[model samples]
Target: MVNDPHALHHRLVDRPRLTGLAFAPDGTRLVASVQTLDDEGTRYVPELWEVDPAGERDARLVTGSRRGDFAPAFAADGTLLFLSDRDPQDPPGPALWALPGNGEADRIAHHPGGLTAFAAASRASTLAWTAALMPGAKDPDTHAALLHERDRARVTAVLYEATPTRADGMDLGPAEPHTFVLRGDAPPVDAGAQGLAGAGDMALSPDGSLVAYTRAPTSTAPDTNVVVIADASTGEERRTFSRPGHQYYVPAFTADGTRLICQRLREETYDSEWQVTLVALDPESGEETDLLPDFDNWPWPGRVLPSPVPGDTTLWFTGDERGHRPVFRRDPDGTVTRLTASGAYTSLCVTPDGTGLYALRSALDSPPRAVRLDAGKPDQEPVLLRAPGDLGPLPGTLTEVRTTGDDGFGLRAWLVVPEDTGPGNPAPLLVEAHGGPQGSWSDWPWQWNPWPFVARGYAVLLPDPALSSGYGQRMQERGRGQYGGRPYRDVIALTDAALARDDLDAGRTALAGWSYGGYLANCAATRTDRFRALVSHAGLWNLEAFEGETDMHTYFREIFGDPRTRRERYEADSPHLDAENLMTPMLIVHSGKDYRVPTSQSMALHHDLRRQGVPAKFLYFPEEGHGIDAPNHLRLVYETALNFLDHHVRGEEWRRPGLL
Candidate 1:
């Protein structure tokens, strides 16, 4: 399992992804959602599994189907409710299904476009969900009829008066997302969303009296969001949280329903970067309490959960700090403590007794798994519970590299080297850039997992340059409006730090990245010629064009300013403007459906490279989006990208796939 690249590649692309942790009302049952490659090996199949909460035994499968079952939750009666597209032939998006102790799972309710988000109250029988509905449609029956009319009329184009027309890979304003609440056995009632904005990211109070949710496209920009709390049964607004230019969202009610714990982020200005903070707000008085008033790291508000113990206002969440996302516990007295020793965590849930937590953690050498974290024990490793199958050990050893940038800024990177690599046998190196430019490479990402490359004897460097998260806001502010300046230099500095080691071969090196990282890869190719090969997946090339057409124009404007109005940065940083200087062989990967960076960037770069007679290859996925998430396509990606690197950096003959 350690030395075989073929077997590693299979597991890397096909392993089950576990997420969505939830404990039943009585804490007797702990369950999660696991997605694995279906029987046909073509699509993913989601299944509900009840794992031992005590962290002692293997998980037990609760239910499954061909169309898929996901997002497991529990009502107060100990009944399990999940989202499933059980009728595959009908193909209506996931409908709500409930599995009781003595009966089979049955469809409880469904909407026109199926369920998007679902939630169950901790101590009550209230269930709230969100789904798409045609404009002005009040209920599921009305929405279904309207949908049928649209299909009967062959409607394809959407009419939007003010909202955005597109976002990343999604076409906005087709069917509006609406919230619905089911209190008793009657029916789900429409919980009127704030104005015309869509509803999602909701939380129910412990007593199930109030449902708090966030509305998207906040009637202004994508950055601004409003959290609104409404009556669970009547669907009437009770409270709304918002500010002039800042965003307050991801509302989680405390166990006693006295305080609402969520996150707040002041919109970025020209001189400062966005800093996210965890905050607690009084539901009735509207007073605010900064949970992490002086805390530096940005805690993810979506993972916030409150302990159910009486009078305990302690909240648990996770955040990226340095190269890991560790679970954090915030005590009632304002003391914030980290619980897990290492690894990235999500799907956080508090134990019924409020003494511990269950979360999913992932690292470079392992995939996501259920783990137990005891409060106030940051030194102890998370206790892992046995999952379904045997995922053998990976082939590499985790290590770190660090250096000081030319500007005196500290730069860090995660290094994964083959177990056999040492002074006697130095291995080739592949430097991969982290995306976001604003996000850090803190976890094991299945799409860009490095173990397969390590299994093939190539050391992988995951560098967090300027503009990355987890670091203080200043580190990210250093690269704002200057995408090509500090980040590129920081990458080179970190690469030099890695190359200085005895276990790595400096001469055999390759560069790769997607999105912002891809932009940096292009910057490296333009400014330096130290690497043998480079790969850019759905990366930006023309900065002005990308900011003008990308779905996240709102985000780009905050960082680089308006390309039309502020053309200086775009002209200086656009990769296409400097493509003539690229010397190393490059692989350009893009999906036809990728609207985030757009396929046009890759096409234009490929055209430029071919015209200049530069050695390059283009891998395209027509049916996939920005992620290229299809199983077979992912297999091809690993085969093709690694083969390209092996041929150029490892000095191996090109082993192209016979199918291509």
Candidate 2:
């Protein structure tokens, strides 16, 4: 029942993680991937667990293995299919495995480069998955031979003639991913290469006659993906659905198979805020209709979960609203119904009859848990089906704070007050900024959980500023070209509003952020020294360096313009230029492998702060990425961050974290 940071961390890391959920054809059984730490606690092993959706029986372990198994899909014939890294153990690569509802799992199909993603058609009993294909290899056999030869010869060098030679959390590729199809007991068929950027958001037709996938036209412009519908049997392109400046993905065919419904992002400019809309396309006529024409909220809310509700024209999706992610259902007539009142939902799945909806719900005080939604009664509380992780009681109470920024825009923030905080004993405030500069702090963040800080008797403020999504398009435009302008002001304005409350202590405040939040933290340090302490994790300090080194160079150039040509935006918004004004004692955390906001940004900031005699400490994780994922590394991150705040904000003696 412990609620402290260390205890919470231990509980979180050791708990069985549930994800990748799928329901059987009869809707009687639901399958989910359960991930648990290995005996040594170095890594995670995934197993498939079957549970009765009716909650009549206890969850049963369907598949037990030390190897990682995930991406569960049920075939039309009641066969359970999943991707596993089981046998031929030396070099582990995912292969398709099947369970016949009452027998041992059997390998159904294998790939040379390992499966990345897969989708199965319930009616057609067909399977499609994406796998990497080696350069110059025409078939899987050739690809496998090339891999074997490379392993034998110890050939590790990768020659990239593409725009992105390196990617975060992946090896530099000599092999490009392509989709493949597998029919019952038949030779696997190549559905064709999805350009150099690989395939994503693959959806198969109910009859298994057509395969719809999204891929970039060129390797240089990976962000500009277009949906392509092709024949599953012959691998022949039938139709290409795309607009000149828009990106389309997540194509799902209607149950009747007349139209393809998916998400479309209007490509205005690299720097401009793109509007995501639900669009339905008549596969025959090529006419596209904006389903939710007036819906301004971003449809793809939270992590990239399953958005489309199968077997009906009605689609269930999530959108951000006033610091909450709520579920919304769009009828075939284009009428949108707001389902859940509050809280964030993801990994959405609807029952076969379309009457019942299921998803994982979470909030500021709760971790993700499986819940069944009453589609008819939109306001009803979701029935909690299961929660694998043991998220003990909250150490604080959660509330919202609202204020209008200097620009007349309404700003909203979530305030977490420690249980001990009140009028008699106000708690120190920690104003935490969210990343995405374009993203909102709405969902339950498992990786960057705020419970640790709340457990430490500090009140945490999470604000949605100008550039945050789910607020209308106008809100996004507020901080578009200017990074430090309205967004920074909105954060400060919200913080001030929160501090006005009797329960929050304003005098002992601190600012902390990661990624874009990190960028804002840097911006805050330069703009004002009101806060006693500041922490920036993988934050962007130099605009010029970030544009050049970031993976999305074209996107950055579109927003800020080229540093060489659009010099004004960079000079005006960059936090590094105002380094001389920084007076707050800072803690800079960065990972060597953070390609998006390269480690160089942190290095530059740390060096500048030290040179300017501004007290600063640098915590570097050489083996980590943009976000810390390793259990030990995550624990150390929280410990160090809390210690930094305790020293500067709470005026406690500094104690270095053991690893540091």
Candidate 3:
């Protein structure tokens, strides 16, 4: 049997995954990087595309092909700077490149190693990108190998600029690497230190005196703090007040350079507690003012919301508190106004002058599209910048159902039924779980996700079980430290209710999830014989092993209780302990380089399943991290999962044989 799910010639497929959006310096235009999933599954030819804020025409593709190009930003002089993986020298990783605003493009320079983050310098033609250059090759299988090599990989942030007379090109001449020391490691040299572990966002004050970025320890917890102001010249820093319980992210500076705005995390919940409040920070005095109402939480590092009104205390940011992050305007005095009320926005960026806001919006039914919101006239409707030809229309008649699980907990979920519903026609059911036992499944759009399940004649059920964010504080706390217990019961009960409906095919039921969802899939397999098949991407099977193997171990006690003190409790709840009960056939996929849920968890599950003579197959991805990073990997994952489900659920003979 064929292992690839896309093997079926007429099957509907979602080949392109869109993410990483940015706006031109002037804000009149925007660019985004999109991942395409074709019949081949996953391939990364991150195409850079341009869109006008006014949805006058479709977005135009800027970069072409799988050689890879993404993360585009226009310089003050109108030169576009973006990251490309076309470096034959680097073997499929990111490198800095430049293009004339008119579309002429050429490579600038290769990164020192893995180019993790890149931001163009404000006012100047200079650009900066983060790199991690390892000392030597180490096996990715062992934790010691990863730790040793990761430690050996000296990280440094470097600034690069095209030489003079190169407005149309990147002059790789003047490249300078900035260095720093670990807290107690050295004499604090500014060159050779890991400044920000996960520094994906960066902002420069208009005056160019101060730079703001998010700093989170890569090997530690996901918590972050905002580093507000740093002398761009000397690297000396001043921080905003320590948000005691919050991890500050995406600290942005206003044009005047006096006030800084940032996104701060307030509380940890599976859902809505994370917010994007417009905070005002005095760069010099380190004082802060909350200029926006405490609204539903948003992801850290505020999205460059609608452009900031020059000299006005009002700024724009996105938060899901009111639902899925509709763009909101926050005035200095703390009045919040909604800008776009229709679909959920994933990314937002404002122009420097504050006259216009460029945003990307996608619904559970569609792929992301670019739009321009004019703050100058609030009543003006958003202009659709670009909509791809491939983006299919959303499903018809979606329903949000509220049902009580057997545990008596009120479970909220979305039910996407086929339009052809009729008597004696039961649709197959696919239960999709969200990761981040701390993460929630929202009413957000699903392009490469849920929509695909629905498109394939499967009734998709996405439940916001206890620990989801939208409801409030209490609901989110219900699942903490209760993994594989009440939460799993809530899901099982939900499934039972769905199965009771005559329109759902109970005999053809399947379960799928990523990250924490991965853990839950394992939980469902061992917990009950309800599902006919299971698909776990970047999933975890062993908790005791994960506690010490993951980067988030610092908070293990907070989420799963202390493993040492509660060994029996941890073991009792772990999927590894229940492996013998995992009667449903399962397929496991993981990235070799994933640090969050390291590959070993999958390895552990595979080894145990093999020893027990269970039906299972494990696919390992090379050159990828916790998530699917390339088209090839994504293709392999999707195809394997779909085929696996087809085999067990539909009684299709398994084509690709499993190791077991």
Candidate 4:
């Protein structure tokens, strides 16, 4: 078995990734979405897998098809329902499918623009999902006809009256996303227009009387969201709850159906660190209460899980702290207790009796795997459940490092070093900055794994600098509206501290980052010549241009305080301003469809590097967006990145990446 870090591509491309976990109504069985690369290695083939939560049986495949299935949920009647794009009889678009426990899956309902999300009620067996409805096309048939006509004519241009003309990983809309309800076997019922264009996070009440979802009221500032509660039968809005300058998402109702719990973030600024808190709101009275008033840790910002125990006032959540994303529980009295010790957990599900809690756990050293935890015992360790396959061993080991930043703030980082490195044979360092600028390096990253570099004999530094969560509100506040200031210094401080160790070599080091980290890498290239090489993937170049071209223009406008008024910020933080100072051999990677950072950013940087007579190479992926996902493309990404670092940092002969 090839378990080496450089050979991780083999494992990553072939290994089945588990996600979107859901528990049965009785909690006896668990179903999850397992995605693997297809035979041609062009796209992922997702299938539903069933696992016996009792640990008596190994996980087994439940559903399979070429188009794939995902988002599995059990209806109140023990019928399994999922979203799929596998209807050969019809043109490919996600449609609702049902599995009657003992029979083959059957298509239940079809949506023309495809279903973006789905939700099911636990008690009433009611279903709700979101689908894009084209303007002037009131029904699915009309929308389908419009889509077919557009495709037949090969028309690609889209007319836009909206602020966001396009989005990442999705085509621009001549249509708006609306919610619909599936009732028995009758034709699907239109739930009316969800005023907010792209409504998501649909949740049905336990009694199936109400449907609650989150959506941004306007297209300009799509980040700002509000929760809407509507009558399930008529699809008429009963009430809407939102706080000014706050974003609400993942709204779930309490067992008694009086209150809705959701993750809420107060929009302090455009670039403010998101310190998400769980808030409970009375759907009727619009009264809101912060469940964790004094808790400083930022809750996990990815997917929100429903309350572990129904009818219980206590709520369980996950948060980042120190260097770990741990499970936490907030009692009815607002007292918070930490549960798991040192790993990241997501897709949480609890037994009906609340005795057992199950989640997909992951860490720096491990990929996501099924695990069971004792919900009642906070101190008990989680037991790993049998997954589809096993990852035998790791080629490297991870250690935690701490240092004081320039501003006296404590900094933490995860250092992944190959087992072969020691005092006698120190490894070259690769300082990796995480994205989000507000995000942390607490969890295992599948897209940008560090093992490949370790396998290539280079130590990887995963730093959580200023603007990183898990450190508390103050740590987050330090990087507000100043991405290149404190955060940059924090990363350098940590790198310097790590270099002081005997196992790491300071003379041969490189810096790499993606997204905001990519922005930081660009900033580092201009600010310092400390590293031998640098890699910037989907990084930001010109602040003013980025703000204008980015999908979230309003958010950027708020973050930088209007480029016209804050010209100083735009000039000071933008990497292009200091491009002439870049001295390191840099590799720039970007995708044509990356609307988040935009490919123009990379193109600008490449032009500057060429004009300045700097050694630079641009690896452009026309088919990818934000990040590379296709198997062959991913292989080229890692091989090129590693080869670049080997040539510059390790003084190895340059070998151009294969299949490029």
Tell me the spans in candidate 4 whose CA falls farther than 4 Å from its real position: 1-6, 63-67, 185-187, 195-199, 219-223, 268-273, 300-310
Each model's backbone clash number: 0, 2, 37, 0
| lDDT computed for candidate 2 | 0.78
Residue 536 of model 3, lDDT score: 79
- Over 393-475, each residue of candidate 2 has an lDDT whose tens digit, in order, gives 87888888998988788889998988978899999999999988767777788666777888778899999988788888888
TM-score of each: 0.95, 0.95, 0.78, 0.95
Q: Write the per-residue lDDT of candidate 4 for residues 246-286, one digit (tens) a residue.
A: 78878887777788888888654745555578888888888
- Candidate 3 least-lDDT 10 residues: 162-171
Error of 4 at 525 (Å): 0.7
Tens-digit per-residue lDDT, 275-374, candidate 3: 4455667877778776654553433324544334456766776554322446767665667676765566666776777666766666555456666776
182: Cα error in model 1, Å: 1.3
The C-alpha lDDT values of all candidates are 0.80, 0.78, 0.60, 0.80
Cα error, residue 68 of model 2, in Å, equals 2.0
Reference-based lDDT, residue 522, model 1: 79
Better of 2 and 3 by lDDT: 2
**Predicted structure 3: clash tally:** 37
Q: How accurate is candidate 4 locally (lDDT)?
A: 0.80
